[model samples]
Target: MRPADLAGVDVLILDRPPGGIAAFDLLETARAGGARLLCDVSDRDHDFEARIAALGLEAARDQANALHLAAVERRAVLALADAILLADPAPDAVLRALGKPLLPVTTPADLKAVLQGGERI
Candidate 1:
């Protein structure tokens, strides 16, 4: 989707940015506003697993610790994200199928430009 289309979204995601594109980097602004950032576990060589391990997360761990468990990068990002971005071929569809808030960002400019519009990315 294009910049104008994402008028009310509060979160942004992408696999990577366009070549030489320095303007868009959705995470920068989203994190600034405390928006969650979700990405597929496979996107970056299973970094999700490492994050979970580092955070001592256990899946289906418990409701009381849901917040704590989710604080693990993978789950936390999803839990806090107002919107999730998908750039991988099937990952986007998979995330959407799981009912995660998902959007598409094709370029860094798309993200950077959005912020330039005076709205959070």
Candidate 2:
């Protein structure tokens, strides 16, 4: 979706790998438009790379490029995020490196609470 489409959005949840540059652009636009950014980093791109290698897939090269782009996009998104949702007991190094507020989310209710402006856990 275009940045204009996020005009009145109160919150934008980035839960998956970015499609490409456009996704990062959209996130920037949404942030500029005053939308709260909540990034859910439940999966790590490096893990996907490892999985592809383990599978002995010929598409590894292309997938690696995409994952690399995703890593870049994720860093940008994290930089703009108001809070981060982490499911893992030990937060990823990226998350810790960025120093953004980390919120542990175990269930859908936790996510809903955060979106609804509930107190940080």
User: Cα RMSD for candidate 1?
Assistant: 11.9
Please provide, for model 2 over 5-51, each residue's C-alpha lDDT reduced to its tens digit, 9 standing for 90 to 100. 99989888878636567877898888788888887777775244544
Model 1 worst lDDT run, 10 consecutive residues: 15-24
Candidate 1: deviation at residue 7, Å?
Answer: 23
Best by TM-score: 2
How many clashes in candidate 2?
0
Return the TM-score for each candidate structure.
0.33, 0.74
* Per-residue lDDT of 53 in model 1: 53
Candidate 1, residues 46-78: lDDT per residue as tens digits?
233443455453542433244333334344344
Clashing pairs in 2: none
Q: State in Å the error of residue 88, model 2.
A: 1.7
Model 1: colliding residue pairs: 24-108, 24-112, 36-81
Residue 58's lDDT within candidate 2 is 71
